[model samples]
Target chain A: MGFLGYRRPDGSVGIRNYVAVMSSVSCANGVVNALSREMTEIKPIIHTEGCGRGLADIAISTRTLAGLGKNPNVAAILIVGLGCEFIKAPGLADQIKPSQKPVEFLVIQENGGTVKTTRKAIEICGKFLDYADSIKRTDCGWDKLTLGLECGGSDALSGVTANPVIGVAADWLAAQGGTVILAETTEMIGTENILARRAADPAMGEKIKSLIRKQEKLTKDILGPLAGLVISPGNIEGGLSTIQEKALGCIIKAGNSRINELVEYSAAPSKKGLVIMDSPGSDIFQLTGMAASGAQLTLFSTGRGTPAGFPIMPVLKISSNTELFRKMEDDLDLDAGQVLAGKSIEAVGKELVSLMEEVVNGKQTKAEINRQDLLAIHTVGPAF
Target chain B: MQEQINAVLIHPSDNVAVAIREIQPGEAILGLKQKISARQNIPRNHKVALVEISIGAKIIKYGETIGIAIQGIEPGDWVHTHNLKAEEI
Candidate 1:
């Protein structure tokens, strides 16, 4: 099951070769984004944090930014900074340099101002892009792929169609010895029992339960007894009522594969098969965390429609409603709404798996074509 | 042959079923081996009471209790945020 990909020196495989222009803090986002826009190969990775946060918050931000640059899909990285930021640009570039990818750093303050820094950043990015574009795609095995599973803007048909279709794909990929990481710890609130039964051992089962309990406690601590109402007006409008009801529907996306391990946000998986990453239910944060954890690609299922995409990984959007699919054709890659229209789940699932194989072999997703690369770091605290 | 209601009946214990499409009031909903008229204009994704429910009874969906009925619900009446309050898990 070898597909055309860029086999990185670090033993990871990437379907696309992208030179990322990463901002170390919110202050440098405009410079990075502008620099990336000037060069076709350089993509901007922007976030809202990186300055004046607590040590724990800064660590999370720094680690997440470094992880994105280290992602195999990124052939090179340009770290942009406002010299006084808490997460130093030079330090972040140093962390990713070990990946053997070409890395550069630009400080706005040191460069005099935004205009001067933007020019220097673009020139550096152009050089990185030139170097990155020279890397050729080679044949890579399915086992080298780590797929991320996520669902957002869900509706009633989510559980009955799109989610299960991805579940089937996840199960198939897992059986083939590839890795699948399911995120959104909040979505697993009430479905712990079902997920636990699929755990490789009793200890893993307990770990899964504990993760759910931790999410419950975190929400309770923030919102008190009415924490269940966190599903919000949107979920209710989409037909979801309780967290338990949403959790039950959400868990259907994980498939029936054995849970091999549980990993923290942005932490790389130790084993293959199915792994769970503890992440907030926020769509962008969840997707970004998975990308940070080394997932080369992500399958995003949405019902009401979301256009979020990552700079490094290609997002395959699957829609459960055919109407929404047609309405948002530019943002969606696959439509599983047929399953809701009486088509068998197996048929749609098999088709989706083939689509993933195509995507791995260089078939550009809708997100790529639309140039919808939305990048954000999961910051833990507010800036001063 | 009559077509079954194009809706998801989440739980066997539930007295309501989710509507997948708009159903005008008085239209016959074909399912559960019974023909029940819609008590009101049920919008897509909204719940319809399958049986008369007393106030304070849990509103079950997805084989789990989702909320509690804020008022008495007649069979075929629409159940939603206005008539149901979120239940603590």
Candidate 2:
């Protein structure tokens, strides 16, 4: 099957063509927001990771900034920075230069101040919008798609219906030669052995094991004793008792596909199929990593429901129960609750894939229409 | 879709069932041949013991060990943090 998408010069396909205005550091956020406000077509990537961070955090921030700019969904990028930030505007733009897309750099410190930089950004972004508008959607094969699989606000039905249903769709896309990224390393606590067992080889399996172990140790060091829960209190109220129960449900979103490789946060996949990314389980943070890793779209399963989306990509929200679906009708895109009411997973999976086709064809999701674009970078170390 | 469903046994091997609807005390859950009645008010999405569980026995839900019973749990008992604790992996 094929969907309408924007074909990038780097051979990547995008379902959205956005002119991105990104802040290299928190200091330039106001300018980035102001410029994006003037242009409705401009997507603002305002984040808080330009300075006062450890080396690990700086590296993560740099990679995340470069990846988002390089994402095929962004037709043009305008990076704004404060001249003295650790991550410079030019350095950030240079990282995305390989994408060969239109990239402009403006510094608030160098270009006078906020007002001048905003003016410069407005003029620059206007040009980007012109370039972005010229890009047309072309027919692209399903093979060009890279999907992000995610779950949040999980209930008991999440494991049985929503996650398993998304899993079925994930398997379908993988069979079509598409890439699927399974993130939230903390959610893989109990199910690491199960997932590792499905790895391509013994070494890959060991990598999966170590990733989970590392995540567990980090959480323990940060949160003290209750770190075993890994999940939030909301998850417990949703019927998940422990991390193991949540992990069992979480891993089902990957389907039964063989894991190809394990990647670091914001790192793009090396090959197509199922790839596990090391990232925290926070909904927005995970979405950021997935989007930066080149996922064209994200399929988010929820039982309690959430209205989170990315600036450039559409987040397809699926709910497992009819009550939550009715309650969050304005936010959710599809209902896999039918599986719990007796429909087959294959049927819901087919419906999900069909919905994906419509979304790629320019059908805006509830998150997109509502403009719930929340972006956050996953930083590991403390700021110093 | 069947309306007003009260509970769902996720897996055949699972020793607990999730309450799809709030199951009142003494309500007979369907699909179980033994005709077990809820011993107490079981909230929706919460677990109900399908079989008697001894102290320190694994509280199996989703066919996986979610926690272990800290006390003897009778069939139809509402299973939660009060009598169960998260298992160490």
Q: For residues A82-168, write the lDDT of model 2, one tens digit per residue.
A: 999999999999999999899989988889998898888888888888888899998898888889989988766888778877888
Residue-level error in angstroms, candidate 1, position A166 = 0.9
Taken over the whole model, the C-alpha lDDT of each candidate is 0.81, 0.86
**Compared with the true structure, what per-residue lDDT tens digits does model 1 show for residues A51-73?**
88888887887778888888888
**Candidate 2, backbone clash total:** 0
Top TM-score hit: 2
True contacts kept of each: 0.20, 0.39
Candidate 2 Cα outliers beyond 4 Å, as residue runs: A229-243, B1-89
The DockQ-based CAPRI class assigned to model 2 is: acceptable
Q: Show the lowest summed lDDT stretch of 10 residues, model 1 chain A.
A: A338-347
